[model samples]
Target: MARMIVAEMCPQCGSLDVRATEPGWFRIEWDRRDALDGGWVEHLEFGCRDCGMTWD
Candidate 1:
């Protein structure tokens, strides 16, 4: 039997139906205005259509 190495999944419910949530102000919110800024955290939001769950 074949085994899955690393399957990306939703933490809420065990389902593969997952989609990436768009970032409205991705560039403006994430990008630093100048070089002086450092150690900024980034997020990748995901939404599950099956159970209507969202997480980052």
Candidate 2:
């Protein structure tokens, strides 16, 4: 199971006990054959149950 990192403010009630509802994503990057190969990037989106705020 993944761990949830709570935020400082609740989007809904604007409380301090903001809860993390979901885990976004995990990204891994590797070197290609050349420098022209763009590096890979990953993002994780977290949702707050209080105000339903999501960050990616």
Models 1 onward score TM values of: 0.49, 0.29
- lDDT on C-alpha atoms for all candidate structures: 0.67, 0.50
- Candidate 2: regions farther than 4 A off: 1-41
lDDT of 1 by residue, 1-56 (tens): 99877655788897888887546534454445344346433446788878988887
Clashing pairs in 2: 11-51, 12-50, 12-51, 24-45
| lDDT, candidate 2, 1-56, per-residue tens | 99997556644566564444325423334354234334433434456665677655
Clashes of each: 0, 4
lDDT of 1 at 5: 75
Q: What is the lDDT of residue 46 in candidate 2?
A: 51
In candidate 2, where is summed lDDT lowest over 10 consecutive residues? 33-42
**Candidate 1: lDDT of 49?**
78
